[model samples]
Each structure stands twice: as C-alpha cells, then as structure tokens.
Target chain A: MVADSLVAVTIRSLVLIIVLLTVFAYLMLFERKFLGWFHLRLGPNRTGPWGLAQPIADGVKMIFKEDIIPRDADRFIFKLAPVISLFVAFAAFAVIPVGPPLKIGNWTVPLSIADPNAGVLVLLAFTSLGVYGIALGGWASQSKYSLLGALRSTAQMISYELTMGMSLVGVILLAGSLRLSDIVTAQESLWFIVRQPVGFILFFISVVAEVNRVPFDLPEAETELVAGYHTEYSGMRFAMFAIAEYVNMITVSSLVTLLYLGGWRGPAFLPPVVWFLLKVSFFVFLFIWMRATLPRLRYDRLMAFGWKVMLPVAFLNLVATAAWVAFR
Target chain B: MATRSPEYFTHQGYEVLETLDGDRMILSVGPHHPSTHGVLRLILELEGETVVRCTPEIGFLHTGIEKTAENLTWQQAITVIDRMDYLSPLSNNLGYVLAVEKLLGLEVPPRAVTVRLLLAELMRIASHLVWLGTTGLDLGVQSMIMYAFDLREGILDMFEEVSGARMNPSYFRVGGLAADLTPEFERMLRDWLQRFPKRYEELRALMEENPIFLDRVRGVGAISQEDAIAWGLTGPNLRATGVSYDVRKAFPYMGYETYDFEVPVGTAGDTYDRYMVRVLEMWESYKLVQQALERLPDGPWQTDDRKIVRPPKHEVRESMEQLIHHFKIVSYGFDVPAGEVYVPIESPRGEFGVYLVSNGTNKPWRVRVRPPSFYNVMAIPKMLEGNLIADLVSVVATVDPVFGEVDR
Candidate 1:
C-alpha cells in the first residue's frame, strides 16, 4: 500500500510542476492580450498566430540575455535568491487539491501531491517564506533601489499576510477541517463565497497585495524602484522571478477557488478540472483588470489600510462565522 | 544617453562610502526612472518611504538649441525652436515667429492670424492629451495611456493635413504661414469639434472620480498659492493655485484679445487640480478651435509684401519679377530691423516667451527662450518636501516638466 501511494505521489509531483509551469506562461500571455483590449491596442500579435507564441518568445529572449552581477553583490546569495523564490512559489501548491481522487484499476490516487491534515498551515508557511527570496535578493545585490524595493516588499508581505490568513479562518471554521479537500467538500451544498462574501472580498484584496500585483505593487514599482528587487537579476534569473510571480498568482487564485468558490464543483455539463480552471481564470482576469484600472497605493497608506481596515473586517467575519456555525 | 553626474556623498570616509547614517538611505530616482517623465534625475534622501529631501538635477537633454538658433537665419530658425518643447512644437513656433514679427513690425492678415490661432489651440489639446496619458501611466493606470493617445492620434492626423510633417511642422513663417490650408482641412477639424466633446466627457468619466485615482492624487501634492508664486510657478501650475494669470489674458497675441474663452483655474493647488486644469484647458482649446474655424475669413494666407513672404509658386513660375522676388526671399532671406523684442504667448505649458535680438542682418544676433517647463520644474522641490516618494512622482506628473524644454 505504501509503495503504491509513493508511486502515485511521484506521478502527481511531476504532473503538478509541468502543469503549473505551462499555466504560468499562458497566464502571462492572457494578461498582455487582455490588458491590450482594455487599452484599445494590439499586444504582441506578430510572434505567432494571434500572438499565441509570445510567451515562448519572451522565454527565449530572457534566457539568451546576459545575466550581470554587480561587483559589490554577495555572489552566493545573489545566485540563491531566485532559486528560493521559484521553489517556494511552486512549493505552495503542494497542499491544494486540483480535483477529486481518481480510481484506476485497483488503486485510488488523490490529485494533491501532499494531502497534509493542516493544509492551510502549509500554504501560509510557504507564503511567508516566499519573502526571504525577495529580501535576500535585494540585500545581496548591494543596489540601493533593490534594497528599498526589498524592504517595501517584505513589510507589505507581513502587513497583508495577517489579513490573508485571518480571512481564511472564517472559511475554515465553516468547513470544520484544516484539509483543503474538506474545504472544497464543505462548499458542495453552497459555496462559502455566498455566505462569507466579506471574507472573500478581504481575502481577494490581500491576495492582490501578497502576490505584488497592482495597487499593492509598490515593491516592484517600476516607476519608483526600477525593476524593484529583481533590478540586478537578469537572463534566466529574472525569468525565474517572473515565473515565480505568475505561479504565485495562479496558486492564490486556485486556493481562492478551492477554499471559497467551490473548486471543481459545477453542473453535469463540465468536468471537475475544467470547472476549477474556469474559477481560477476568473480571479486571474480580475487581477489583470485591476492592473489596468487602478494606481499603486502609497506604501504607508497600504500598511494602514491592511492593519486598521482589513484586519478588523476579517476578525468580524470570523466572529460572524463562529456565531452562525454555533446557532445552526 | 547617459547623463554623467559626479559621485554623491553626505561625507567622505572609508566606512562612510559603504554605509552612512545606517538608518537613512539615499536613493537616486532617475536620470533613468520610468516616472521622472524624461531624463530628470532626483537624488532623494529617504527616511524609509518618506522622502526627506528631493534635489532635482536637470540638463541631461541640453542640446544648446538657443545657441543653435543664433546661427540660423530668421526664416530658417523655426525648425530649431520646434524641437525644444517637442510636445507643443507649434507653440514654440508661434512664440519665436511672433518675436521676429515684433522686431520687423510686420502685419499678419486676418486669414493667417486666425489659422495660427486654430493650430495653436489644436497643439494645446495634443500636448495635454500626452500629459494626461503619461500621468495616468505613472500613477499605474495602464489603459489610460492607450485611450488618451488614441485622441492625440486624431489631432496629429489633422496636423499632417495642415502641415507636411506630423510632429515638428515648421508651417508658421515670420510674417504668416509656409503655405495655405488644405481644401478639406476645415472639414476634418469640424468633425473633430463635433466628436471630441463626447470623447472628453468619456475620458473624465473614466478616471476623474475613480476612487483609486482620487486616493493617489487628491490633496497629495498640495502646494499653497503663496508657495507657488514664491517659486515662480506659472501656467496651470500657478493657475491651479487659483491665480488667474494666463499670458493670453494678460498679454494677448494672435488676436487672442478678441477670442472669447475662459482660463480654467483651480482652488487647491494639488495634483488633482492640475489634472482638472489641463482637462478643462483641452475643452477651452476645443472651443477656441471652433470659434477660429467659424470666423476664418477669405484673404491671402501670407503677407502681401514680397520682402516678407515668397510669392505664390504659380506666380514665381509665370512672372519673371515674381520669380526674382521668390528667389531673393528664399535664398538671401529677409532681414529684421536692428532691435530687440520679447513676445510672451500662452503656450500649452504656461508662459512660453521668446526674446529676440536682431542686428539688421539675415540671421538673429541673439535668441533666448523662456521655456515654461524650466520654471515649473524649479518648483518641484517645494512641492515634494515632506511628502512620500509616491507623492513625489505625482508632483512631477502635475508639473509635466518636459526635460527637452527644461534643459534647452
């Protein structure tokens, strides 16, 4: 039984990496094209038909470009920073179930690579660790812009992570289980989004900040800090950071889908993965839309908004969830 | 192009170069930053995200255009001045040519004068459209850049029809115009007049009251009226302080004395007010264009005197005397009387003034340009004091300093 489960785990690990890497590339292409429509301009239509190969072109270009390290940089940490970021970005997805278990022959295999009992703990732990990559990268580069960007990014992460984790507690209380599959299963009757709308909203805003997307995108603020923490990184190193960001975006969107939006739950017309994909795509589109519409929030104001506003709203949501669960 | 600056330091020591004050960081925002608008460099003293002091370093784009102007003849100098404030090239053309005309004591016909007014207003709208688009981009609204520039494209097409070039159209001559307007130029402008009001309303609806944009701009880069004046701020930057000091109102040119238009002024001199002033100015410019189009009279496009303007190409081809006059005007170039004149015009930015000194030869003895961006950018440090780094960007955006003009 152990050997069979181990084989199943190996297959799942390989599949997740391949699938997520592909999704990250396509998500970038989707964003550029969608943002172009918002701007009433054509975006990268010349690479292949309808610019379908634009991401591939971007990858090739980034890979071939020269990677330069500053003379004053810590060479060991400078090389290690992106690796840690890319690893954590991919690792955060290990706990989230992609779909229901598959039954083939005599063995039943779960879609998740690691179905830990405390899945929320695992995800949050990984999310918190993701900042070290940015901070270390900035500190190592010895460039002033990177250090500022790194400082802003690290502070922003700490501020928003509280709201992000607290927002999920209301959903967790309702589900009555720490496992992500149970979170999805509890929403079979009615998605948590309908009952916990306030939680979802707070969580969504925090996720935008946590992922360093627009409005909360001050850390990598191209206008202020050049390319931010990744200013000194180039070639495949920069590409790694880029991919890590997109993967984090996807991971959060799916977590939102699984935890609140009823992951893989839909009518008889669509398959489970398709339904999950559709839900995640909706959040991804919303992220890109926010980028097109809003301006970056001031750093101090962003901190104030997170602590004073979002944290209290999340706490109120948790209390409301507990009361409803107790009475019902 | 790299702008070379001497190394910056608070103090000099072996350990000091490595780290100073330990808590405070000195960050250089640009000669290469995305939001500096051009090659404007700000050496910022940062206490965390809050900017303690911002010292702006200009002259990255200085090409000595005024020095270059002294070498060109009175007629040939329009080409050089247009490249100064590239966004509002025609306004530069108008200021320079008006200076020359004032020196020569030349009279422009109603047709030429009216056409100049119409083109100048169009240039105003075009310049503001670029400012609106780019400012939105700096503040992180990605779609506004494309939408705003779309309107600017229509204005450029109109420019191409009127002048041979789209950008640096040296169409305005010393006395009048290089050539007459196209037969269908009036129709294209009429279409724009009918269509642009709705588009302007749409642009306002998109961003003016947006909560995110409001949060970024409202009361963020506040500069008082007293501070604005003390800093020598003029144009919309000054007008946003509720100072009604438009050059057109104070010193009318191109028969601006007769044109009925209101100068839009603001109460609180902040980024939002500056944005409102520019948008309202576009509306006012559109109104001015409509008025100029309706009142355009039937007359010669250039001055009647052969010494001031070249004869019509057909006349030059057919008549020997006309040919001689055209050759003399085109080759030798007409001389301005020995005198000095300073003509100030209400350029899109603010007070775009040109000072001219003629020595009675074909070329100008000395030319000096008082570019509005030069004065406006000088007031940046005043606005950015004690504000956060983000507000620093918004103030720069509000100033709309074109480094080309600032450095030139």
Candidate 2:
C-alpha cells in the first residue's frame, strides 16, 4: 500500500511539473500581449491567430539557435549552471498547493507534490540554490560584465533574502504553520493582506528584488552590465535562464496569493483551483504592471534599502504579527 | 645606505604609501547601448567602476548634412535641419529658416511668427517627452519610455497634419512656413494641452517620489555650477546647475521676450535635477504654445518678398514676371551678399547656431553649425569621473545628446 502511494505521489508530482511549465510558457505570452496593449501596439500576433503559438515558436527558435561557449569559459561549470538554475526554479513549485484535496475512487490527491512539514523552509532553500546558477554562470564566463553582474546578484540576493525571509515570518506566525496548504487554509477567515499590510508590502518589494525585476535589476542592467550574468550565455542555455525567471515570477506570485490574498477562498461560483489561479494571475499582472511602470533601483541604494529599510520593517512586522496572534 | 635614505625622507616629511600603476582598462560603452538615446560611443578608461577618463567617438550617423544643405537652396536647408535632432525637427526647421530670413532681410508676417512659436514649443515638449522616456528606460523605469512615446505620438500627429511628415518636417522656409497650420492641428493641440497635465501628474506619481529612483539619481553625477559653465554645457544640462542662463531669456531671439515662461533651475546639478528641469520645461513649453495660439494674428503666412518666396501657383500661370521669378528661384536659387552671419537659436538641446559664409553665390562658401549635442557629449568624461559604472546610464541620459547632431 505504501509503495502504491509513493508511485501515485511521483506521478502527481510529474503532472504538476508539466502543468506549471506550460503555465510558465503561457505567462510570457500573456506579458507580451498585456504590454503590447499598454503600448498601443500589437505584440507577437504573426505566430498564430492572436499569437497562440508564439510561445511554441519562441521555444523552437531557442532550441535551434547555436549554443555558444566563450573561449576562456569554464565549460563544465557553464553547462551545469543553467541546469542548476532551472532545477531549483522547477523544484520550488513542488511545495506550492494549487488547490484543495481531490478524491477519485479509493485514492486521495493532496493537490500538491509534497506536503512536507517544513514546506516554507524548502521553498526558501530552493530559491537560495537558484542564485548559485547565476553566480556560477557569471564566474564561469570569465568576463568583466558577467563578473560584475554576478557580484551584484550575489550581494542583492543575500541582502534582500534576509528581508524576504523575515517578511514571510509574519505570514508563518499568523498562519501558525510552515506548510503552504496550512497557510492557504489560514486565509479562509480573512486575507492576511488586510491584517498584516506592512508584511505584504515588505514581502512584495523584497520578492521584486529577489526576482531581479526592474528597479531591482541592477545585476542585469543592460545599459551598464550588458546582459549581466547571461552576457556570455546563448541558445538553449540562455532560454533555460529566461524560463527560470518567469517560473520564479510564477512561484512568488503564487506564494503571495496564498499568504496574503486569501488563496482559493473567493466567491463560491469558482472552484478552489480557479480561485487560486485568479488570485495568482492578479499578482502576476501587478508584477508586469510594475515592470512596465517603474524604473530600476541603483546598486548602493538597493543594498541600503534592503538592509536598512526593508529588513527592519520586515522584522517589526514579524514581531507585531506574533504579538497580535498570541493576544487575539 | 638604506638607513641614511630613510632618515633624509623622514626629515623632508614626504611619505609615499603606494604608487598607483596599472594599464587603465579601456571600455567601449555604446553604439547600441540603452542609455545612448541613439547610436553614440563613449570610450572609457576605468580604474575599477570609477571612470578615469572618457572620450566620445562620434560619426556613427553622419549623413553629410552640411554638404547636402549646400546643394539644396536656402529654402530647402530647413529639411536638412529637420534630421539634425529628429525629435524636435520643427525647432531645427525654425532655426534654419530664421537664419536664412535674417540673411535675406525678409520680414515674416506676425501670423507666421506666432505659428512658428507654437510649433517650436510643441517640438520642445515632444523632444522632452523622448528624453524623459528614454532616460527612464535607461534608469530601469521601463514604463516611462512607453508613456513618453505615447505622449510624443500625439505631438507627431500634429506635425504630420502641418508638415506631412512625422519626423523630417522641412515645413519652415526662408520667407515663412511651408504650409499654414490645419484647423485640426490647433484642435488637437488644444485637446492635448487640456489632458496632458493630468498624465504628467500620473508620471510623477509613478517615479518622482519613489525612494528607489530618488536614491539612484539624487546626488549621482553631480556637477557644480562653475564646472558646468567651464565644460560649456547648455540647455537643461546647464540649467540643472542652478544657472538661469537661457538663450531665449538672455539674447531674446525669435520674439521670445514677449512669451511668458519661466526657466526652471535645479540647485543640485545631478541626473535627477536635470530630469526634473526637463519635466518642468515641458509644462512651460505647453504654456507658451497655448499663449501663441491665443495671440495668433490674422495676416499673410509668408513674407511678401518676391525674390525670396516663390510666386503663387495661380500667379505663375497668369503672369510672365511671376513665372520668371519662380523659375529663377527653383532652378538656380537666390544669392546672398558676400558676407557672413552667425545666428544662434535656443534649441531644445542647447544653443544651436548656424554660421553661413556667403561668397556672392547661391551656394554658401562655408556652412558650420555649432551643434549642442557635440558639446554636451564632450562633458561626459568630466561628469563620469569618480562615479560608479551603474551611474553612467543616468549621467549619459541626463546629457541627452542626439547622435545626428553630435556626429554632424
């Protein structure tokens, strides 16, 4: 019975991975379309009717493109870096609960790949691992801009991670569980966005920094650092890094929806999965909106903001949330 | 011997810690960089991220405009100027035409004066919009570029109605305008003026007070007033250093003294201050354009000088005298007296001056343009000294040098 359950879990995990990967592909299309609308231009419409096949075209192009390795590059590490990046990005989605449990005949599906006791901790660990890919890619390339980008990314991730982790502590304290599914259930009464507005603000900003979005994209600043850590990367390997970024965006948006915006607890007309997706899409829209609207932050100021401003605010929110939960 | 040398050095009170010696790293910053606005290359010497030296290498977009202008008549030179800035083509057209008008000693009617002012101000706003958008994009505010471009398209549409070209208008002539402003152009300008103030507020909300943007640009690339003047920087780049020196205010060319507008100045001559100055300048230009429209006079659009302006199409068919004058002007062009004249105008970039040396011929002996972009680009090396590589984008954007003008 235990072996059968294990097999079932593995299959469920594979299905979730495939679904998430498909969603990540479509999210790029969605962003391009939305940005095009905002700019009063048609985006990516020639690939298919309304550009439905655009992502497929892009994937095929990326696959067939010549994979270039720099002359002085550490070939082994360069090849391994993108894989590490993509692996960590895909792995983080394992703990994310997409919906409530499903029952079919005698078997039960928990709606997640894993409901590990330390799910939040696992997510954080995977995110940290993703940074290694960027750092390694930068270092292995043996280029100045790549090295600078790597240094910036390393410093940014380290500084912002503190605030990001602290910001999540407030949510964990409020939910009183490390599991994402438990956190989603905790939001059934009231969205944490309302109760812990400060935490939500901190988390949102830090995640933006973590994902290296505009205003926090100093590491990959095209003007100064060329294409940053991926300056020397080309072809399918570069595509993997790009896919990892969009996947990371999805992961953060999902986490934000689950923790703050009352995951899967919208009006009763929609199923729990639909509600969860709707919430995640809203956060995703916000992310793209910001990318379209805001400017990038400077490196020193970004560091200062992460350490001096966001860190303190996140810690205070955590302390306040714990106190509020203990009393109320 | 070592002890004796040390004793002498100690008595002299000369202490040497470390000798700075290394090959200065050479970095080519742009011909296709996001911050370059257009294709511009800055060869930088770096000691770490600090720029030790910078030399701007231009000529990437040299269209040989001066030689082209000589082949074309004085009336056709307006077209050549249009390509100089591209963003503020009308202003370029106006500057060139006004210079030729001065040489011809032709009196453009009051209506033409008012119309030229209106178009010039609109061009100013359009140019500033491009600057704001591209600068924001360079600084990582990708949205501002979209917003700025959106706003600029409205202005360009107005240009299209009057000049029939969105970019190279070539609408202004030596005597007056190529064509009168269409009724729809006025209506569009009025509508944009009414709605754009609110949109500016929205842009400000998105970026102005955002702590991240402020911290990135606030004190970075700071130049003192003295240094700004020494470097020969002008326009918003100079005005950012708290200087109230505007050619319009200082010299009062093209009936600018009559216009009611204030030159916005910034105390801190940093990237942020320059950005703010340009933003405020747009509002001022809007005010000037509106006033020009309200006070627009009813008169002939072009000068009455037969030697300069071609005879009307109807008159060319009817009168032999008109036919001869038109034929002479079109085929051979009109000649200026053997003399030289330097006419300076307050362009959106800076003081755009045209120096023409006429040697008793239709074609000019020498046509030298004192382009503002070249000088502005020259100041990059000075501004970038000791600044981090990250701040280079902000600094370069604030300078706002158009490559066509710089290369020319």
Itemize residue pairs with steric clashes in candidate 1: none
Expressed as tens digits, the lDDT of each residue in B74-181 for candidate 1 is: 999899999999999999999998889889888989899999999999999999999998888888887788888998888888889988789999989988998889
- TM-score of the A-chain for all models: 0.97, 0.96
**Residue B29 accuracy (lDDT) in model 2:** 71
- Candidate 2: regions farther than 4 A off: A1-6, A170-177, A184-197, A260-269, A317-328, B1-26, B45-49
lDDT of prediction 1: 0.88
Candidate with the greatest TM-score versus the true structure: 1
Alpha-carbon lDDT of model 2: 0.84
Docking class of 1: medium
Q: Which tens-of-lDDT digit does each residue in A7-53 have in candidate 2?
A: 78789878977887799889999999988876667878998899999
Tens digits of per-residue lDDT for model 2, B35-142: 777888876656766777666767899998888887776666767867888777777777777777777677899989888888888889999988888887787777
